[model samples]
Target: MDIIDENFSQDFHCLVYDNAPTHLKRTPTAPSAKKMTKNTPPVGKNWLVEVNMYDENGKQIYNSDGSYKKQHVQMSSSGFTEDGTPQSFYFEPGHEREGVFKGMAIILEERGFKGCVGRNGRLAECGDFSQGCVTAGQPDCCCRRMLYNEPDFVNVWPRLEEVANARGFAVLFLPKFHCELNFIEQCWGYAKRVYRTFPLTKKEDEMEKNIITALDSVPLETMRRCDVLDSRFRSL
Candidate 1:
């Protein structure tokens, strides 16, 4: 499948942007207790988690106003059952998608993605712990599900300069979780519908031919319509 279009080079800039938008089902993991208890105090239900303020030299950190700085707190968590049973487990805050993205950011930086800037105008840097730090301590209930101010790409950002200088490509990351923005997705739907019309027991070569024909059969006008719709939604 070669698409040789002179216009591709004539009009298009040598830039590319993509993201591996992974998703996970958010199953209800709400802790059992609803009210404040010994384990479920005002801050949160997570028993092992606590805020311990400290300075760069490991000394207790305090603000100029004689108050502890929440940003410099030592956060720790332990793995235990919902019933408060003791378990031998260390906290893994960067598990699952967060973990993968953090590693990807580090790898991209090492591979010449250093010094890149994001679309949001933030310099490519590792996660900023201070950005999400609380200004003051509170009980678990008051602090439960608190939103932190932080960049969305803090976990998976590669530097922009290194991408252009080292890789000679520009990147444009799309908004997260918006499939309507990608016209190819709509084209794929049309192709899939066409593919389903073929006989199920087709031979291997015939299947390949059918698949290719189905993909090519997508109307250009339909593709344009998808783009228009996407633009309309973005305007909203």
Candidate 2:
């Protein structure tokens, strides 16, 4: 991103990435109901989400021993209510337990969901979330499931997209398991085939030269054809 901004400041670019887990990971502090408690926490105890600590310049802080430093922080906002009012996951400043995490029940109640709290309290999530209530056509079967289905929660962008969008670059993730849709994969294959044709060499410098030569040997016409094929697959 720094190189792009420095060399081509005026050009708009949209980067495409594979749907890998590393690329789709959200920031640790992003809102999530996966581990939220069903009711308010015990007195003097809080349920803050653990997140990596960052320094003044926004870089993650590392401990002297090399692991990342961590701290408990409130989760991000739980989106808005039906009337357009913003919802928060923690009690407001004036409350007695201010800054403490609001468990799933109260959070759902604030979003106008009734029956979230009962004599027995609600379940944090369904028994088998993916194949349970959702598959049974009961989206509101549990507090956590309902929150998970909320538009704001469902639409939260991954960190990569957030950073790219902030810098005026659009980011798109290619569909998972579809290498044919990635034109660069074809170019890499072509380079590898050319690389095998080179004479065997033991010298490091000679090996590097051979690798670069093999890559450069790929024809521009082949790249164009691969791109066209990728576009056709995408259109389908």
Candidate 3:
């Protein structure tokens, strides 16, 4: 071709690219539809859901006390009692789970987060979490066909297959270290900063609610950020 290939790097290119994201060459999943089905509207083939919880008081410290004796402190269990109830059941010297699991579960259920595939995914269970936990640990994939308990141990790809039923998202999981994919992470970070700005001595429930409110204040860059309509008119 007699055209300059450097046009892609020109200011004009940047302006065009900035205004609209490059359209995808292909749809990775689903079949083409000529008409809208009663159950199926124009939407993404997958659905996305994510849940995360944080507790600043859930800190831990370890120190060597004597020649070989090491001491460990579970700051989470030692926080306080607001409703006349303890945070966690202390077992051994260095073991404490504080309200971690329960707190996380509540957040997930409250937000209506279901098991689906994305990066670092966990299996979604119908009712009893035993199956979900098993899938989360082993995950139904070619690699590691067995089952386990920890989600970190399983390959999240299998979870992606399980998530196929959801509508409203792509097959890919949340992007790592990417601010655009999961805006909630930034919201949480911002909320944490805002909450820690002033010294606080509030009830546990109140504190949690305050942080959630702060997180909700973030505004999404919708026009440039949300997924655009697919160009179905182009026959491919």
Candidate 4:
């Protein structure tokens, strides 16, 4: 971001990344119904999402033994409803179970989706949680499925995008399993080929030097050609 501001301040920038798991990961507290209970908890109990604790500096907190310190926090709001009212995952203040998770059934009920949990309604989830509804085109087959397909739920942005948008930049994730569309992969392949030609060395320092030299050996022309090929593929 600093480099972009320093060199290309006048132009809009949108960083493109491949659909790697790390790149697609959302913040731990991001709104999600994957683990939410079907109904509200028992009296004196509450449901919360477990997330890694972070210090004031935004760094993850760790225990003395190096394990991450975990804390339970309410998931963020599930975005606004069609009427533009903010939808919170937990019940509002002054309610019987104030601040407790509303559960999938209640959450859906507020969205005007009724009969999602009782005998006449769908189950908490279909037989295959991953496959969702028993048949395609049956989004209301289950409570969880209904919530999963909700517009707000489906449109939750990844953490990377949130960070980039905060800095006045946009982010786009390339299609998954399409290496030909990501020119950087070709650059890495070129670097590996160059590395293979260097003298074999088991020493850590020499290996590091060879790797740096290999990466630097990728020509500007080769990078441009790879990018052009990717652009052509995208157009197709």
TM-scores, all candidates, are 0.37, 0.88, 0.24, 0.85
Residue 106 of model 3 has an lDDT of 25
> Over the stretch 55-115, how does candidate 3's per-residue lDDT look in tens digits?
4774443335523223322222222223444333122345343222222222222224433
Candidates sorted by lDDT, best first: 2, 4, 1, 3
Q: Considering summed lDDT, which 10 consecutive residues are worst modelled in model 1?
A: 141-150
Quote the lDDT for 70 in model 4.
96
Better-scoring candidate (TM-score), 2 or 3: 2
- Candidate 1: where is the Cα deviation over 4 Å? 1-6, 9-18, 21-131, 135-171
Superposed by TM-score, candidate 1 places the C-alpha of residue 54 at a distance from the truth, in angstroms, of 41
Residue 33, candidate 3: alpha-carbon lDDT:
14
* Candidate 4 lDDT by residue in tens digits, 154-231: 888999999999999988789999998999999999999999999898999999999999999999999999988997
TM-score of 4: 0.85
The 10-residue segment of model 4 with minimum total lDDT is: 128-137
Model 2 ranges off by over 4 Å: 128-130, 134-137, 219-225
Superposed Cα deviation of residue 235, candidate 2 (Å): 2.8
Residues 176-225 of candidate 1: C-alpha lDDT, one tens digit per residue: 67776666788899999999998896488999999999999999999989
Cα lDDT for residue 176, candidate 4: 90
Which pairs in model 3 have colliding backbones?
Answer: 46-169, 115-124, 118-173, 119-173
lDDT of each: 0.42, 0.86, 0.32, 0.85
lDDT of 2 by residue, 111-223 (tens): 88888886566577777686757554788888888988888778888999999999999987889999989889999999999989888899999999989998998899999
- Alpha carbon lDDT of residue 226, candidate 1? 89
